[model samples]
Target: MRIAFVHRRGGDDEAVLGQAAALGRAGHDVHLVAADADDLRRTPGYATARRTVTVTTGHGGDPVAALRALRPDVVHVHHVSADPGRSWVADWTGPLVATLHDHHPPCASAGLHRDGRYGGSRGARLPLAWASRGGTADDPLLRRADRLIVLSETSRARYTRAGVAPERLALVPHFVPDGTRGAMRPEPVWVYAGRLAQEQGITELLRRWPAGQRLDVFGGGPRERECRAAAPDSVTFRGVVEHAGLVRRLGRYQGLVLPGRFDDGLPLVYSEALAAGLPVLAFDGSPTARTVRAEGTGTVASWDASLPAALRAASLVFPTLRAHCRARYEETYGETQWVTGTERLYAAVVRAGAREFA
Candidate 1:
């Protein structure tokens, strides 16, 4: 299949690149259409793609003319917000599929965190209310897709409640390449890799950090200084680490700490940790926590006094969970599964012909 992947140049660039690489590996002719030409040539996917095109414009250069020239069998959009005016989806009338990478349209903040809490004013529950408050743009672009790819059941439910048809929504979680390089024994320490922001529950993680427990935090953000000050001596702030470097070092840690308080679908870090045979310690009420509980790949605890005890218990069971974590990643979050599922969706959409919701 000739697949043309479109995305705006931003945060989800790595994920988009990964998907393009996976499809390319599967013997499909994959092309990339990026909104901005800047820094794309340096990315690994830039070289992996059969051909790459950039629409260096504010409103995403004439989508019809650019895409029609490619003559792709399937057009997969990694992020709809890439086009500020969203003219690309409006202009393209083909077998289009889009992945809702974050909580947009309904939750304007995109992370589902606002005002120090998760879920911004019942946006995920009451779409009409959210739309009334000048939040109307992105949802229609999602609904217009031939298939809407959601990362988790949490996301699927949120979009379903927000008026996307159940039939159109496809639950396809993100995948990361396996980074485990052998029988590397893990040290008795926990690792956290993400933005050190309040929304990520970094504040609570530092404030309620348990003594005697060792934690190494990677990545920088707004709360870095505050978190550094508040964190105990046992906690080490490793600053920013590139994704490839972090994944390479993941097998050295006993477990990954996901203290996010919001419903961020399923973070790619979760899959990365699992791929490295590392269990996860996620905070309660998150999609990652739910997966950890269901898969028994790690422990889920609330950010409170009991967190210390929870960590201790998780450590005790960590030895037994390592193999299970790796197995879970292979079964659910591996690239083969993602590519197979994506290919199936693309084939189905192509057969169904070009159809759009009213």
Candidate 2:
């Protein structure tokens, strides 16, 4: 099938591009429609695509016009701004599939971390209620899609409660290419590879970090200065590492640390860590923590005195969990599974559209 993926050149565009590459590798003709040429060139999936078409909405270039010209059988949208007026999906009337990488219309904050709590006190119920009442700008656009791809069960439930038909929502988690090249002994050091922010629990991680435990911090964010000041001598700030480079280096660490206190619908890093055969150390109440506990892929701990014990426990079992982590990745979060499932969804949506017209 010919598929055209539309991305708005946002933070999560790499995942979308990676999915396109996965589909391309599966023998489907895939084209990327994006706004930035530099990103298209530097990103991992660009080189593998059949073709790429750049769209400049500010310069009078219509994305719908460009997509219509391509005449793809399916149009898959990855990430677009929440504004219906600015979104090109509003004008497209074809077999369309949209992936919601974050909680936007239902949470408003998108990250679901509000007032220093994950999903606030009421979780997504309040925002979902607001969305159900047509309180969000993107509600209409979200409803218009032939299918809405959610990355986690939490997201699927939130959208469903927001009045999206159950049939329209598909739970397809993100996938990452395997980063392990053979097997290498891991060091006793832990790694954190995302934004250094309060909501991510970086501040709490630094404050409550066990003494003598080595942690390498990657990426930069709003709390960099605060985190740096509060960080113990055992924690090293490695600055921002490119995604490819980070994935390559993941296996060297004992485990990936996700201290975030939010229910971040299946972060891409989770897949990357699993791909590298690296276990994760996630905080309690987060989605990653739930997966870690359920899958035996890593350690789940609270942001308290018990965290040190959890760290020690993870160290003791790290060797055994490494293979299990990789196995879980292959079974659930690998490119092949994701691509096949997505293809099925694409075919279903296309068949549904055909039946509607028939």
Candidate 3:
């Protein structure tokens, strides 16, 4: 089958590249159509894709024309805008599938975090929800999708409440490549790797980080410098490291600390940590914490007033969770399972679309 995958930019670009490579290896002719060439180059798997195509659509280029010219059997879109007036879905034809990386069509902020938690205090979220309203279960653009892929059950439920048709949603967890599974550090040094934004809870983590354990911070974002300046001497800001190097460093940590106070659908860093046999430290109620508890790969701390106490408590049991963490990775996040499940989804959607057209 000829498949074309599209993404606007960022980490989603790397995810699509991974999918394209896996599908290509499975004997499918896969093509990647993205908006960012620099991001494509940074991703290690992009080189393995059968073909890579970049579109200037976001600026002034015609993505519809590029996609039309390719004529793929299936068009799988990832991380693209869903605003009714700006969406590319209306301009394209064929079996259309979308991976909802976040709550875009429902919540304008996409993080679904507004008033100190997921789905803001009624006052804040109502306006954004009103602006991006998809209009019931029969939303035109969303309904047009043959299938909607999400990273977790948490995401599927949230999108449903936000108005996407439940029938169109499917839960497909994110995948991370196998990493260097080194032994956990004997002394319980921790690491926080990802964007340094407020929604990520970096500020809160730094403020409340237990002085007993040392933390190495990785990745660069808007708040990197501010967080670094305010952080304690025990915290070391390593800045941005390549994906491969980040995973290697993750392997040596006792656990990955994600103090994010928002509703992140599911960040790839969660998968990366587990792949390296590192347990996760996330707040309860967030998708990351839910997955960790469900899989028994880590501990979940309360996001409210008890966070510091929870953090200290999680530190004590971190070593015991290592084996469960790596084993869970093999069962759920391995590349082979991801590829096979995705191939089935693609074929099923294509067949259903063909029947409908006929």
Candidate 4:
């Protein structure tokens, strides 16, 4: 089967590509399309088609043009908010699958971190999130898509609540690559990965970071400078790294510091940390964090009013956290399970003709 995977300018390149890589290796001739060239180059075996469009618009013709040439059996699109690339799905005769990587369609800012959290509060900040956006989910362009791929059951529930046909929704979680690094050192070092974006809660983490333990921050984003300035002397900033480097570099840390107060489905890094046999220090209220705890993967902070104590406790539980983290990674975020679940969704999509059938 021939497949066409389309993603926008920026995102987790390794994760997005890893999701498609298994399909390619399974004998599918995969052609990847992205606004940026670098994002596609990292994924092996993908015939990349670069789309050049500075602004987000429903009319970008690059994706449609690329689809025309590939004659793919399936077109999987990521980050619909950046560029729904609805044009390709609009005219395509094949199945057009849009992955709900973020809550972009109904909410703007893609990640949905509107006024404060990543859930992007509704009301005033909602419109602001979509202000300069070229198009939104309610647009006729997105409504024409053949299917919607959501990474979590919760996200799929949102799509259902938003009136998307139940048949159109499939929960296809992202896959984390195997990161074989040196054994975790016996030390009290905490690490943070992913972009230092607003909703990520990195700024809040740094502001309230405990004084003693070594905190290594790895990632670069709009909030980098502010986070750095506010970080305690114990915090060390390690800018963004390639996928391999990240896993190896982050492995030494006692655990991953993920004080995510926002919701953008799930950060692939959390799973990566777990896959690396490292625990996580996620916020107590996060939906994903709850999932992790329920699965016995990581520990969650219970301090709503006492964050300092929570951080201190997280530091102490580092040993047990690391064990549980690896356990959860294998049981849930493991590559085998991810590939199986994703392949099942792809096959289901291929067999179904319309949303009702899906």
lDDT per model, in order?
Answer: 0.76, 0.75, 0.71, 0.65
Candidate 3 residue lDDT tens string, 1-358? 8887776664466667777777777777776666665556756665655353333233322356666777788888775543542355666768888877664445445635322223346676565466466553434446667899888888788778877778888887868878675664545688898788878889877876656668999877778777987788888889878878788778887778887767757777888887877889888668788887888878887755665577677778877787888888888888888878888888888878873211
Query: Which residue pairs collide, candidate 2?
Result: none
Segments of candidate 4 deviating more than 4 angstroms: 34-69, 79-84, 111-137, 140-142, 354-358
Q: What lDDT, from 0 to 1, does candidate 2 have?
A: 0.75
- Arrange candidates, best lDDT first: 1, 2, 3, 4
Candidate 4 C-alpha lDDT tens digits along 1-358: 6777776644445456666666655555766666665545555323321221111222353566666666666777765342333444555666777776665345455554421233334674555445425444545345766667777666777667767788877766776766756466746778888778777778988888777868888878788889989998999997867757777766677777787776546777777887778877777667667766776655677535566777677667677666767777777777688767766766777787443212
Q: Give a tens-digit lDDT track for model 2, residues 229-265.
A: 8888999999987778888899999989998787666
Model 1 clashing residue pairs (backbone): none
In model 1, which regions exceed 4 Å deviation?
A: 48-59, 82-84, 111-138, 354-358
lDDT of 1 by residue, 1-358 (tens): 8888776665566678878878888888877776564666566556544343323222344445656777789888765442333545766778889887765444445634321233436545454344434433345566468898888888888877777778988988888888778767899889999887777888888888887899999988888889989999999989986777889899899889998887767778899998999999888888889988888999888765487888888889888898999999999999999999999999999999754421
Clashing pairs in 4: 112-120, 114-120, 118-262
Query: Per-prediction TM-score, please?
Result: 0.87, 0.86, 0.82, 0.77
Off by over 4 Å in 2: 36-39, 42-45, 50-62, 84-91, 106-108, 111-133, 136-138, 355-358
